[model samples]
Target: MLQIIQRKRMNLTLPRNLHDSLLKHAVFLSVCLPETVRDTFLVDPAVILIVVGVVMFFITFCGCIGALRENIRLLKTVKFSFNTLLFAFLSLMLPQTRSALEKFARKAIVHYRDDLDLQNLMDYIQKEFKCCGWNSYTDWSWNLYFNCTRENPSTERCAVPYSCCTPVPGETVINTMCGFGVQTQKYLDANKSIYPVGCADRAVMWIETHLLLVGALTLGLALPQVRKPRHTCRVCMGGRTSRRHQKGLTACWRSRAPTE
Candidate 1:
């Protein structure tokens, strides 16, 4: 506290008129931008999460109310909005741009190798699909660890991943060394040694194969809704018949009453 007082005492001061002018300007700013007083606070991770949580809560709350009330118009609006967003996402991910996907795959492997989840996903894709690299095993040449050159001088040079290897029966563990020097070899030898194609071609094939499945699922979802009105129409007709019969019985009893 004593040191703080000494530091303040040593602080330089402007002329009295200049000090007065600066003070007036500060007061003017405070009055003009009163709402920004707390805006100086840094937005940290916790604050970001809280904001996201609140936004999601509001959206979900509105959806729940719409569902319980059976508001078709509101539900349709929400459905259309969500579908539009999904369509946009699918448009971007579609296999139309083969070159773009190939480029993205090359960068994804190199930059995201340290990211465990992405790395695991790539590993699974390679193993499950029995493929390697973006366009071919040579695509690994762009990777620092796998590039076949003296400047880089890596142990993994001219090597594909173990996922590209053909599994030997009765082997509990993978032959990690099976892919070594396979990239530098000819395709005739490499065909027996490793997967010969690129991931982009395989991915395109997978998407093409599953398109009919996606269409079937979509058709299945829509058919139930289309058929729902048929069931409701029968119920509505039954209700009308019952109402008509009730009216006829009351009229018949009134007419049969003797001149009362």
Candidate 2:
């Protein structure tokens, strides 16, 4: 009777613990995998901005030094070093679900208007980049206030943003109404009235015009560290230091140690 009771207790306890352990393991796998992959590959917009800034600084420093010295060897070295990165960027394929730049711009504007920061960013980009809407002034047609539809009774109908207009000479205050009703006009008339060309076209033209200059700048950046070196990369991955660079660090520490 005593042996029978002991055996029954053991059987019940083992299954209960095993069931709990399996449940925990299942939860861990489900919660962690997708988050880990997302964080590893697709970075946040703010992080992207920071990375771009750092690269620009690096390019300027390398280009200035190499150009001032007129060092052919250094320039050639940098050019060869950056060839892989340049190729990667040029070959990068981003998703184009919307299929057209005009449609994409309209979708972005309408979808993100409620997000104040995004709205301000779009306005600033248009003003500072000397650009209007995405594909052209007509892209504002997607906006509720600017849609050309007569059935819509908004006061801002058939209008584009003021940033689309050319500024007057010595103008201190901006004329906010300059681009109002410009969208209703034909391209030939609007060309004289306001900026008729789309921001997308402007951006494309800029890229095409400066493609060679961009290539030269990219090569002049001299970031040969971007190469596939396991030791150096590991150091860079964690706060820009590694064991390989720890030489003399130990010496400094020893020198600081108490001595007789």
Candidate 3:
């Protein structure tokens, strides 16, 4: 009876082609899974940071050696410098690092904004982060404006509306309504609805910090190169002149010395 039952079960087993088809379908479904699931489950910011740091380290190391060796070739030096700056900037400005910095800034902004004391808030930020002036307040004000006004805008999209400064709020209102500006108040309204105040603040902070760092690094690295003129052989300096005159050049003994 047991043998008979086993034989019946074996007979009901799926054919090889059917089994393979089912497996292929399963794999197809797996392959088409949402990207977010993979991002959420497999992505590691720390690993990315480490990889970027390593690349930057290598570039800086190579650049230092090339510079020390006095490799006067502009192409080599420029290439090295560019790679060094790119990798270094990546290490500092990666999305994860920016997000962390933004989170800190957002928390600070929210805590202070909630107090409704702009002066105190500015003072606190100035003391803590060494950031001062009306720009900071204006940024917060814009943040509030966008947050209060928008409906379901993306954080990335909200910045567009805040970048412009119209003489009157009505102008801004009109501009937004007409979609005349890079960012409209409608977008801002949308972003505000979708995200919390803290998220916007954080995103802004990240962008500001990373941009400042990138600007500083770019200036620091590029200014010296720009200020210094490239050294070249006399022949190279003459450029087209050398090419044109090459066939007509007299031998040193054939040319007479100039009279004083």
Candidate 4:
């Protein structure tokens, strides 16, 4: 589980038959009858360990090839510093960019159940910020499980995710039902159980308040990217200069008169 958490993305090319075999094995593991092995195969510890092993092997092979070939692009880390800064700046300063972020946040909430990773990320964000959905707690209505429509069959209908709930002191175990039926309540009533402010507003306000820190971090990341190419050029020029000096000395030595 820890190994899988560390891997951001994975793609490996293999023979079609080998790939199909692995896929079939993975499917079998996912549906195994043992309660311990059932359904959660994607995050199973053994599966994660195997994935980590394969990833390590692939990376080691690539590193060896890059080193042998002296491929600067492959040896050095890929720099996205400028693009990252630009996107961050635009998201902070432009209304349209901010709107897009808000919409994305809301969409994540709407499809919260579709991806476990997304659900975990959303939970973390909400818990950290002490905020609810994108616009309001009611924004969760867009999720099928939490839909407020009369026809929705989910037991959690009209409820926000439990991440929105205010923590109660001395509670040993989390009440997963803490946010139950929150969307159905009046604003004042719901506020008692969960955060009232939207996550988008909280995030924006945080950025505004920490503008100096953000700027410092942006500059810190950008400085290395700006300097790296210049440093590489200097090294190459130094090598050329050394070679020219050595050649001049060699020519002078050969041309010098020798006494018998």
Candidate 5:
């Protein structure tokens, strides 16, 4: 009888302990899994770029097909849509949109580890521009791992990424730890270790210095869209055009027409 009682207690205690252990592990995974997921998908610009590429290819393909088929309705739709996008892109230079762009830059820094491509791009920008974070070196604090908060558990807390570090003169190998604990120092002191300037200001200065080149590129891209549709429209209305007009339009479209 005593043996039976002992066996029953042993069975109950062992199962209870196993269940508690599994419950503890479940709670730990629940906390840690979301953070991994959040870090990965929080702000992936590559995905956005992929989506935009697919959309632009679809639009441009439709435009080319419409022009070839002499489909007036489809041609008009493409022209209108293209113009809308062009104007919208130009409007990004406006103050409100520029501010929004700056906000995006900050967010990009916050999620710097989310995408490898973005991380590499940011490192290149920082190294080439002699800049640090988006608005300032301190902007790295926006990243959870780099945050200086007392509650943060990251080993990288209070440190900047290696890309922000100033290169050593004539060093053959890169020093990954050069930026360690940089955020704990004063600006004057940290400036010795990392670039003090912000990438946003450097980018703006670059654009301003190359304003003419920027304008020329914009016009170059826009002119083709603007002129191609006019040629297509004239070709579609060939019956109304004089022989000279028809010949000129045909030559223009033939010269610049999109190939399949």
Candidate 6:
């Protein structure tokens, strides 16, 4: 009889322990998987860039509205949101900056093909030197074009003789003209300051910066705020306490009162 009782108790304890373990495992699995998936989605460069750009644009828009209305609260919110968006935008641009540097370096090498000495020097460095503790260009992009030479012989000299020239390829020239024209229209629509520079490279940079800033500010202002239950409860209690005090409630009674 004692053996039968002991066996039953052991069986009961095992299941309860197993149940507790499974519950804990389930909780871990639920939280960990979703977070991992979320991180995976967020790590994409295009997604991050778009998200930050949209946030910044909204915040800037709100800031403009606040300024026009002379609302202090709105202005403060706008300022905070703008700063946050700016930080995010900068973070997203880090990867793009690296990509741009790599692209530029590759283009430079192609453009300076006639300079065998420079090519040989680059090849030697690439083969022998490990930059940022990496054997290949996989680790660093900006370092690849560090102290590189510019294409133009004179700073004052214009590369293109005309708006449309053989020096610039037809497709590239068309794309530049179209992009600038579209951006010029956008500036006009917004009544914003338009840069006088007509050079393709300068114009492209300007447009990119403007677009990125606008997008980041916009999304920051529009993103929904996360609500914390504990915070909400505290706020409710605070208001109730203030109200009670206004009605001449004693400190002792308030201290002894149970929280709802």
Please list the C-alpha lDDT of all candidates, in the order they appear.
0.68, 0.65, 0.45, 0.73, 0.77, 0.43
Query: Please, what are the lDDT tens digits per residue for candidate 4 over residues 118-175?
Result: 6887899899999999878898876767878775646888998889999999999999
TM match of model 5 to true structure:
0.68
Which stretches of model 1 miss by more than 4 angstroms? 1-62, 69-80, 86-100, 229-260
Better of 2 and 5 by TM-score: 5
TM-score of each: 0.58, 0.50, 0.27, 0.54, 0.68, 0.22
Count clashing residue pairs per candidate: 0, 0, 9, 0, 0, 21
Residue 111 miss distance in model 2 (angstroms): 4.5
Model 6 lDDT vs. the true structure?
0.43
Give residue 132's lDDT in candidate 1 (0 to 100): 83
Tell me the tens digit of each residue's lDDT in model 6 across 46-162.
565789799778778778888768688878998787677578668876658656554534443332223444344444433232111122211111121221224222221221111
- Across 56-126, the per-residue lDDT of candidate 5 in tens digits comes to 88788879989778688878888888888888878755647768767766667766777787788778889
Q: What ranking emerges by TM-score with the best candidate at the front?
A: 5, 1, 4, 2, 3, 6
User: By TM-score, who's the top model here?
Assistant: 5
Candidate 1 residue 178 Cα shift, in angstroms, is 1.9
How well does candidate 4 match the true structure, expressed as C-alpha RMSD? Answer: 17.7
Candidate 1 lDDT over 121-149, as tens digits, reads 66788888888888887777665566665
Model 4 lDDT at residue 219: 92
Name model 4 segments beyond 4 Å from true: 1-95, 218-241, 244-260
**In model 5, how large is the Cα lDDT of residue 154?**
66
The local distance difference test score of model 5 is: 0.77
User: What's the CA error at residue 84 for candidate 5, in Å?
Assistant: 2.6
Clashes of 1: 0
